[model samples]
Target: MTLDEQLKQLAIEAQCHLAKTPERQRSLSRLISIICQSNKLVRPFQGQFQGVYEEIYAEAQQRLFLYLCKEIDRYNPELEVMQWANFLMKKRFFIEASRDLLPTIPKGVDRSRIKRSPLEVLEKQTPIASQVNASLTEEIIQCIQEDHDRLFQTTHIEHKPAANFQYIALQFLAGYSWKEISEELDVKVVTLSSFYGRCLTKFAPKFKAYLSQ
Candidate 1:
């Protein structure tokens, strides 16, 4: 089969694996293991298709797994197996990704609670919060939103999948070191640095406005 056809087949197989019911769990487990092993056959050609292999395959895997878990949940909401797997995989990814990017922030310190000081902004901006309080968190919310929008406008990321950008941002938020991010994301450290610098440059003005508020 052609590469495209192969990828399509992989997607279908992945969907099937993820949708396996409790009665078929063992069979599905063996099937997915085999598929993953077979797919690794392309590892030798990774130098030629690194980007496609990593980004495309990673996305496919995520979608397949998510779809499977979602399907299982639909069948039996009380079944915690799929949910546990989903959480475990997601948590590991976040922890591994963050371990290499930014410093870990302590919990319950008000990540979304905007602090006006330069020092605080320096620290808080590491893991950008998704939601800020409408009243007390308005400053951060507006600034991040503005900066995020501007970055999208200025970059070719507008053409890329939104999930790609979000994934990159999540790495930074997870406090992954730059080198770790480079390795994890399969990009050069310089590339990650430049991308982040662009984000900060676009975000700075908005951050200032937020502080002013």
Candidate 2:
């Protein structure tokens, strides 16, 4: 049987409408393990994994499984299970995991090879004053908003002149997903993320220097 058919069969057996019993729960758990562990289902995330993402992968994966265990009923079978599972993984858990890793990065480290999220960078750097939070984030955000120098406004994403860094940063800060931005700007998520990192590396320090003056 095709993997798709097999998943449907599992869903039927694990339907939450069945009688509430420990045996039913155990059987459902076993089925969820099979679905979550399927190599084909998780290959998308696994294949694209890199840098800081690999560090929390295993932990995030457990949370994904636990999510399926309790919320599998929420899964829309009309959607391919793989897409459904990975979407939840990215939207619900991975975004937060990436944010938690951002502040720990070495400030001077090269970002050429390190893949991090725009959300991870900005969400961690808030205007709040506390021992844990830094004011650098506030300064960079201010520079993006004010742009008296027009640097951020003119710094487009490579050839995509319409996608200025100022606009991209606002979208990220406003809680738009990278996928949404990519679709809107007709760019790949990979390209947009890499460009944002380079922009931060090039622009953030300059903003800080001016702010410190």
Candidate 3:
């Protein structure tokens, strides 16, 4: 059988067993082992920082596995298993590797909530929360939404006609995580991420110029 068939069988079999049962545990273990062995998942995890990157990846991977274990029932059969896992990994863990860079704020300040400083924005590629004001954020939102020249409208993820750049930018800038956007668009998170990254690289100058004016 093909890999997807195998994954489907394994996922279904694992789901059939009780959450903490030996059968379920074995099946889940087998699933992840296969994923790693196949190298179907991205590895050495792409990160912004060379140092401490692997460390964060390791931690994020462990967390991802745990998340999958508890939430395996939610795994959709229509999608490729590895793609779903990779989406979760990249959405939740990949960028999370940057946590290592955000250690400037002192601990024990407040458990309820805390805000990042401007320095943290420079240190990591995160949501522009700390970098821009409310009006600036709204301005970006409006520019992408207007699509007067269809620049954003014309750009889309290859093979996915509905997944336009404007939609992705609005959702992303509106603070949707890659995983969430992936679910909404029914597109692979990796593809969306690659497209988003390319758009940022290509359009950053325009974005900056827009903000300056």
Candidate 4:
């Protein structure tokens, strides 16, 4: 069977288990495990939170499991299970990250004496190290956004190549996979991967400088 057929089958089975009471817990847990195993959902969080990646990954997985159980009834069998699972995983990561960054007051301390996470403190300082890290993130984001915009605009380039660049930006900067872009654009996976590699090669120098900023 094709990948699409397999995903649809998994979705159907998951929906069936979700609707039934006796096998619900076991089946849902199995389905969640399968989804987690099939996708590298934590890759996007690694570069941004390198020091705390393990914590973030554990939190994201736990939250995703809970969320899938809570929203199982709303699962759409027509959609790919892994895709939806990855989407929820990314959402959970951001939610957990934000929660972690929130200032908290100690039991006996005043609200003004709230403690901040290391990330928050780092962002607030004006040291050279902090400035370089902040500048790198800002510049990379700006450069990617500019490239994304240019790809979408009318330019003196072939339509296919322009579209390929836009898809590459979406994959790298937007955390999409080649498979997802292929499905969306109705292009073959091999073609998209090849073009994406070319795009990366072309942008390697600029990206290197941004990372070193």
Best by TM-score: 3
lDDT of model 2, residue 142: 67
Model 4: per-residue lDDT, tens digit, 1-213? 654456556546655753333245334544554555456454444454444445445544544554565567677876766667777666444444334433342233234323456874553342321121201233554666677556433321245554556445444344343344556766654455445444544555566655556
Give the Cα RMSD of candidate 1. Answer: 21.6
TM-score per prediction, in order, is: 0.27, 0.41, 0.46, 0.40
Error (Å) of candidate 4 at residue 206 is: 55
* Candidate 2 displacement at residue 79 in angstroms: 2.2
The residue-by-residue lDDT of candidate 1 on 1-213, one tens digit each, is: 643344334334434543322223333333333334454322212343323334333433432332343333333323333333345344333322222233543342333332245763464355423321111133444444455555433442334343243355545444454565556656655455445445544544454455655
Winner of 1 and 4 under TM-score: 4
Which portions of model 2 miss their true places by more than 4 Å?
16-20, 43-51, 104-213
Question: Of 2 and 4, which scores higher on lDDT?
Answer: 2
Query: Of models 3 and 4, which has the larger TM-score?
Result: 3
C-alpha-based local distance difference test score of model 1: 0.39
Model 4 has an lDDT value of 0.48
Ordered list by lDDT, greatest first: 3, 2, 4, 1
Off by over 4 Å in 4: 1-7, 17-20, 101-213
> What are the lDDT scores of the predictions, listed in order?
0.39, 0.56, 0.61, 0.48
**What is candidate 2's lDDT per residue for 21-135, written digit by digit as tens?**
3333444444554564466544224443355455445434534554565555676778776677778666555544444445653443334424546964664364222111111
Question: In model 3, what lDDT does residue 85 have?
Answer: 84
Candidate 1 residue 29 C-alpha distance from true site, Å: 51
Q: Residue 167 lDDT in model 1?
A: 52
